[model samples]
Target: MPIGRADVSPPHWRKSSYSNGSGGACIEVADNLPHTIPVRDSKNPTRTPLLFTPDAWASFVTAVAIGRLAD
Candidate 1:
């Protein structure tokens, strides 16, 4: 049997630690993909996930952690 495109695995999405059970605002991230991290709104999983390179993702995470990107 030939392998099909749809046979590919889907991303394993995890909610951000900062997210709360109330669901006011939340984003899920898939860190399983090689060299890529995908993020999407938890309330809208069917939407296209935003892809980020490993390095870029790392930098963005660091900035957020240190409050450089905070409002």
Candidate 2:
């Protein structure tokens, strides 16, 4: 439900700092473009990424860091 036009410039994806050292199951995030954070699975780089607004991405990161998403 994002309203503004999403910047479509090619993203330079970077692996999460917390990713497994062996490149196992992990997520990559692209912070290059404006107003968007592109996230994709390392196991499937060719697949479309899930886009999140800056605010939303920050919130999600905070939640994860605080163990709010733990099972």
Candidate 3:
């Protein structure tokens, strides 16, 4: 199923730990939401967020953890 604009709530967000300290490559994630992962640009918090299924997010994290996404 495709995610629609109404599927996610407005949220308070935080930047990913992998983001550069200077804010380049900043990635923002919302907390306290169930069943979905909402991510946006830390530099543009007001923009529309990209939504991920929780399982997809988990797999992405696992890949990063195992060095699959590293340069």
lDDT (CA) per prediction: 0.84, 0.89, 0.83
Candidate 2: residue 41 Cα off by (Å): 0.6
TM-score of each: 0.81, 0.81, 0.79
Give the per-residue lDDT of model 3 (tens digit) for 1-71: 45554446666688899999986899999765777788999899888899897889889999999999999
For candidate 1, report its TM-score.
0.81
> Of 2 and 3, which scores higher on TM-score?
2
lDDT of 2 at 29: 99
Q: Which stretches in model 1 have alpha-carbon errors above 4 Å? A: 1-8
Model 1, span 4-63: residue lDDT tens: 422245789999996778986799998887666899999998999898987999999999
Model 2 Cα lDDT, one tens digit per residue, 1-71: 36777687989989998789887869999999888899999989999999898899999999989999876
Q: Give every collision pair in model 3.
A: none
Distance from true position, residue 56, model 2, in Å?
0.7
lDDT score of model 3?
0.83
lDDT of 1 at 41: 94
Indicate which candidate wins on lDDT.
2
